[model samples]
Target chain A: MKQRTRFSRTVVGGAALSLMLSLSGCGAGSDAADGDTIHVLVYGDAANKVEKELVATFNETSKVKAVLDTIPGADYQAKLQTIINSKQAPDVFFNWGGGSIKPFVDAGLLLPLDPFIAKDPGLKAKFLPSVFNSAVVDGTSYGIPMRGTQPVLLFNNGKVLKDAGVEPPETWGDLLAAVEALKADGVTPIALGGGDRWPTLMWFEYLYDRIAGPELFRKALDGDREAWASPDSRKALGKIKELVDAGAFGTNYDSVKFTDQGSPTLLATGKAAFELMGSWEYSTQQDAHPDFAKSDLGYSAFPSVEGGKGDRANLVGNTNNFYSVLKKTKHPQAVAEFLKLMYSDQFVKAQLGIGNLPTTTNTERFLDTAASPEFAKFQYDMVKAAPAFQLSWDQAYPQSAATPMYQALQQFFNGSMDEDAFIEAMRALPAS
Target chain B: MTRTATPSAADGTFDKADSPGIGAGRPGFLWAAPAAVFFALFAIVPLIMVAVLSFARWDGLSSPEFAGLDNWKLLFDDPVMIKSLWLSVLLTVLGVLVQTPLSILLGVWAAGHQRNRAVLSAIYFVPMLLSVAAVSVLWRAVLDPNFGVPAQATWLFGDGNLFGTQAGAIGVLVFVSTWQFTPLHTLIYQGAARAVPQVLYQAAQIDGAGTVRQFVHITLPQLRNSIITSMILMVVGGLTTFDTVLILTQGGPGSDTTISAYYMYQKAFKSFDYGSASAIALLLVLVSTLISLIVVRLSGYDKMRSTMEGL
Candidate 1:
């Protein structure tokens, strides 16, 4: 039996295979970084409006135009890491500084801002020194403070506190007392978004700083394992365990999330009396429950511990968001000009107008022009007066340490892990 | 005049050219080439990359350096990894146990031509219509301990902290998946049940068999092939379940609901431990493939005997 020739079919099949292979290659490809405009990628949110305005303001006079790109807040970090080394990497990008930029710094993907600082001293002199220092990896400046400082604060619903006859806690004893009063009044003493997990980390950050001072944490973050097992660490964990046992956060906290406004809504509806959160809670409240924000939202520094080593004036949270440059950017001069806008009067006013407390030295001058001058002054003064402002433990650690750390935090809060295990987890984190 | 010799292409595709008149209608290898090519590009190539990455110490940044078997070694020694594997197996087993009987019953009931049955079946299928992510989000909002249905129905939810403990988180994960996936499996069984000849039921009735007896003696035996198909799907789906766990519990209240799939994601994206994540991925592939092969073998599913061959 003679078989018919099938060479034509084989060729067609090969052609189809190659065609699809090329198509799939296109799917994996990215846009070439050859544009005249410098792309400034930022964390997208209500904050994008200010970034857009800044980019537009920069484009008015600069020869190399500026373009604003934003990845939504939840996805910004993961997406940035995926694109940072690719052709699609932005010319300048927003970051939380510290370990957020450390990976990129180690990879040599970030451009040090020292040259720009050398040419224009105001670029370094303008922003708060502490905020600027956050982006300095190994004493080389790699970032410029762009937006605002977010110090952890004890926020409350004024009506709930009044109804319960409870004051915002001024000391650990007072906070414990307030928790009892709030619990008796049938309002959750603290609205914790344990499901979101990072909110749980906030409690740990403040408690550790309050009990042991920022030095212990700074030591621990610098790869000193002994710091996590120190007496102060256990004391902080003991205090957290005390508060949790006293039902400060209530029973259903693990099911609540900040991203969905679960815990904030608890405060808004007076179901909860307090939420210890970042300065951004002000903006969050104002956006979600305008009536509550207008009349009943109250803020104060985290309560002090009576015999604690830490000073009451010490703060812990994100110092500020920063704009870090890419080493591969062809338009360094243009990028520097755009970063200059970060410290400009227009930038401060726009930031203040949106309720973000810019960390610029000139931020004090624009305080009166703020959306809520009173609120802005409260944050600005606290930031200025803080003896030491520790960055959040998650942001302070390298990116790889985040999950295990968050898991540890959540486990400790939920009674899944004891203090020892929590300490061991913290000790195992990649400190560099 | 009948020649049983098979005429294959040069590539040995087992062509039917020597068969009487059947060869004329047979399409060439080009017909399947596109699909083969697409699968190779999307699935096979990425799978190969994952295998290579499993042996390397790459953090998605910097050039990968060979780490030999370090990732695999760490995975074996890790308690969380071991727990995740056990959790994956438990969830898959629970899914099969819960879904098989429920879908079979629902499928048979829905096979009726009654108007209400048709309406109810359509309603049941709505959850399947929603994307897994969308369904997860919807359920999360609906089941929120404070504002969700649990708050209103206190007796049912008992403090409503469904994500607070290991048992509760796993329960939510399993329950949410069962809610979203039962309809698909039910559809499979429904079609299979419909294909079961009416004559067998009539014969059973004539023999004085009750509804239960007919279902057991006639309908179920006919549905043997579909049971295997649907079971394979459920086992694979359960093992790889990620979205429901992610959106509902986030493998949280402290890694309580950390199934292998979600654990792998946490490693890759959250922790940036790409090597370990790739190892976990390769392990998952091996496990599901092994489980499916075993299931097919045990059921004698590859024997390829038609249920209607006698008729």
Candidate 2:
């Protein structure tokens, strides 16, 4: 027994030693630093090929070669926060350009782009002023628009609409009527990605903008707690509840996600009538079901609310993806050259090919050559003529407020929160 | 010079002269040093760091600043955190109640069916082999209202919406967790059952004890250690249920299924409130430890320890 115990102990000790040695080897080393290579990190997606192609183009003649790195979409923010403070921080990084980059800017980890803009007036002048302003924190630009504007649009399946013998809703009343008609015809009125929580946010965004106007959100964004408690805000909340009760979004919206292609699939397969999504839905659908996208896909602005204060053409979404320079970058000149390429005609044409409506001044000239010229013209005209384009609430608020804000909106939509409780929660959001 | 020898050495009990020079009748503290160092580096250091961080204000990007009980104060008042904790505790309790007996029965049946044991075990363990992400996504697809089993059921019944309601979400989560985790507990119980001496069971049967009686008196006592251990592990897992909930509901359908760990993740990663997240981590640890201790005590773990020592 003693000898057997000793043998087992020796075996255990040997295993432990081997485990320790193997684990030591598992510690990941940092990426090799290239003296003449500047790293560019972006959110990985179908768009990654474009970034890689651009990087290759830049590396052809540039002194400092641009290396593209991508973190998967869901893990991007968390991974960026982890690496941003370390020696592995990228020279340039992609961001949503608003509250997404505000924390980094506050920490002084990001470099302001004012000097770069001053050096080259075309860099600042080439992009749309409103779109470019999203990246400007406290009147100081910190990011350059890298992708096209993504204004939220009411996407509908033409086949589903035609099957129901109903036209796409032109006003809020028409939407309610269409909801009834679609329900009568045995189809869901709207396919909402409520499981993602952020998709449910679109309803609140469009409704608030239409009912109370942009100033209501502007005041709320500016930290006026009363803005959320106003009668107009309550009215908007009531309208959303009304829609929910009317089965406009159906009962299963809470279980479907845009991220998972759940709600979009419903629309594409004609199980649902409409989906309020960003313009990227066009590309997404075009990829998933080319046949449906070609013949059945239709896009329009959100229906106007009766007696609403906001403009009919008002839009809401991300202005564009931006490339912000980290203060620790070793190649500022290379980064500047990269930013300049965002406005070049090639950039405009490449983005249009992917169904993205670039906010560049040169974008209009290339719209005729777009993958879907009609859709591109519609988004461009809506953005250009809009009196206000309220940024998504989650993007407009600080990062800390995002989870709670989404929770509040979701709770209100699901009837877990009353108007008062929702107002209270909004007021309780972290100021910083 | 006076020669002094330790009791162990002087007693000639160990035959020190015949023993090896290294670790000769002595506890090898040096051999344990490596394990101690590893534990200190990985577990102790992180635990201490979390304790310290709970009292500071941090936003991941910014430098941490001292916050003097503010995180704790906020934790007490935070409705979401409170709800999450309650849900976590509830889930843990339910998991224990639901999984223990079911696993034990399955484990015993598998052990008895010696010829088909391999096939039976394999069938039961398939869910355990699946990754949590895969399990969640699979269940999500299976329960989807459009084309899933629930939708198919609607043809027989009318509008089966299982994953859409709060109770239904919780029920599905619990059911899925059981389906995936019962295999693990069954394997554990099977090992413990196998470890039980054949002589004891033969004696029980010779005394005219039935299978049910044998299990109650012999198997139950034999499996005491495993039952307590598995219960604690499953309970801790329930408290920290994140992956399943994250992929399944994302704490959705109005935050009904949001467990504490998921809330902590959101607090740290999404909100960037590392300080508060650390506080939550510490709180969850305390809760888990306290519950484990209670389980150990109530399960007569101390009594078993004394009994084993006497043997």
Candidate 3:
């Protein structure tokens, strides 16, 4: 009995020790706010090097030195949400303008940049209007564009398209014809990373913009419920259903994820004819399969819908990353000075060097110096000519609405939910 | 106050006052305080917080506001929630049913093998040693409908989408869970089986009983405590399963394999709806508690305790 008691006590002690260790692994946010140092938190990725270099440059001759902190890209948003309300909140942080920052804007946690814009008119005017406008909530700008615009384009494998006897689709009808031709040639019409959910959303975003127009999304963003029930929305949903039924995305799309490079692998290997992805696919392909990227990579704007209200020149995707200020920060001026670097000529050159197409007005001249001049020029010209640029719906809506919205899209594509049900799901999404 | 046989009210209860043991009075409360505090901090406090959060509307970012029963009302009409709840219960039932018998057989087999017991035990326990994330990723690659081993094998009969269908996803989940966790139960039962005296099996063999008959009559009855312990563990693990499901299917083709815990995770992390997530958590806890209680009662754990004391 004594032995048993001792054994159980040891077991309980071990369990408690492990539990404490696991709990200790959780973030106890750092204190970078104690001195004259300003904390700048950015999403950690390949782009972190650029941010780090920039922070070092900022610290050289400033009264208030800036410190850079990074959270891994996958966990960045969740970590930010947890720490934002605490005293550990960064004075300046990275953000995607649209709905990503809306909650903070609503909570009045973010500082409005209008006064900064007033101080220097060139600050707002330097970046592309569409890119600059994404971070503006209630006519008050909350962030400055810090990175390049990411427009979703139809990325095709040239060799596969050639084998299938099809050109890169220029219109909706042409895309349908390509799909049929590609299917006949025994290729998956498109490689879609439906398992990731976000990749599948690009289809709906482009379709809605091309069919109904950007106003519908803007109305929906403004919480106009009827915007979802409109004929344009139904038409877009119908188009999605038609594509699914025709096997445009092939079977088992839901099992593949972009994060795992499953869809990209399919496209590169000629198992699939086309993929619709962001401009980043260029770098991704270049990094993974250089031969394919150098020879057979082809990209084109999304096809225009026949007799649709929206412009053929319209674009859809992430506008850019931004640096938004916290309302409670002690060093707003230092942050403003730091943000000024985002629009400088040095910033444009550095960003372009990394294959990021800066949205700064001066970026046009620096495109020739970009890592891939052709890809940079193509993306820049596309954005420049676009009459309207629709933000991705997931990013445009509040974070709370993301799961339901994705579910509705998934259900629709999978044929489990009809157009009305999809619309109802949209209507049911928590208001931004 | 009656003082015939019992102590007077001023002298407290008869047993407590009569007893001179170290834990009889002040020392008893003091001795128990640390464990009580630990329980209150880890278990009781979290439960209370979950209960309070269930009735409030808070996105993890903002402060919580009183939401009344709106979250519950939403849950009533939520198809995904209902499906997930059913799926969790189904998973738990399947886990206990399939895992118990299979692990027991493997355990008994290992126990009887004197020459190869170490090797056999090592082989059986390999899956349990692997991390759940690693196992899930390995299975995902192995079951990929396009390039997976199963997909290639299925091509012999005809092509089929393995992870595309609801039933197929559930089957895969159960199979993977069993594959990964059966080893743990095997180890548990092996220990219990070793405790049963060798003389009993010898006596059974002398009585002209077959291996099957000996196992049914001798091995199983001795493994009662281990089996009950493993069942509760397996049931709880199944009900709260998230990592494998998240990595393997992500509760998809269209939320078909979603369990309640996965839904709760989606609400809290994906949607940031802490209130709704808290509600789901509370519901999950209640379901788990009731299920555990039923298991304990049906398995006669109280009777087992009394029997142990009588021994």
Best by lDDT: 1
Whole-model lDDT, model 3? 0.85
Error of 1 at B2 (Å): 31
Candidate 3 residue A290 C-alpha distance from true site, Å:
1.5
Tens-digit per-residue lDDT, B163-269, candidate 2: 45678788878988998999999988988788777878899889999988999998887788778778878987888888989888878777677788998998999
Where is model 3 more than 4 Å wrong at Cα?
Answer: A1-33, B1-35, B156-160, B305-311
Q: Quick one: ranking by lDDT, best first?
A: 1, 3, 2
Give all candidate RMSDs, comma-separated: 4.7, 5.4, 5.9
For residue A175, model 1's alpha carbon misses the true position, in angstroms, by 0.7
- Tens digit of lDDT per residue, candidate 1, span A276-393? 8998898889889999999999999988998898888888889999899999999999998898998898999998888788998988987999888998898889888888888888
Docking class of 1: acceptable
What count of clashes does model 1 give? 0
Q: In model 3, which residue pairs have backbone atoms overlapping below 3 Å?
A: none
In order, the candidates keep a fraction of the true contacts of: 0.73, 0.53, 0.48
Put down candidate 3 lDDT per residue, A286-311, tens digits, no spaces.
99999999999999999998988889
TM-score of candidate 1 relative to the true fold: 0.93
Best model number under DockQ = 1
In order, the Cα lDDT scores of the candidates are 0.88, 0.84, 0.85
Please report, as a residue range, the 10-residue window in candidate 2 chain A with the lowest summed lDDT: A25-34
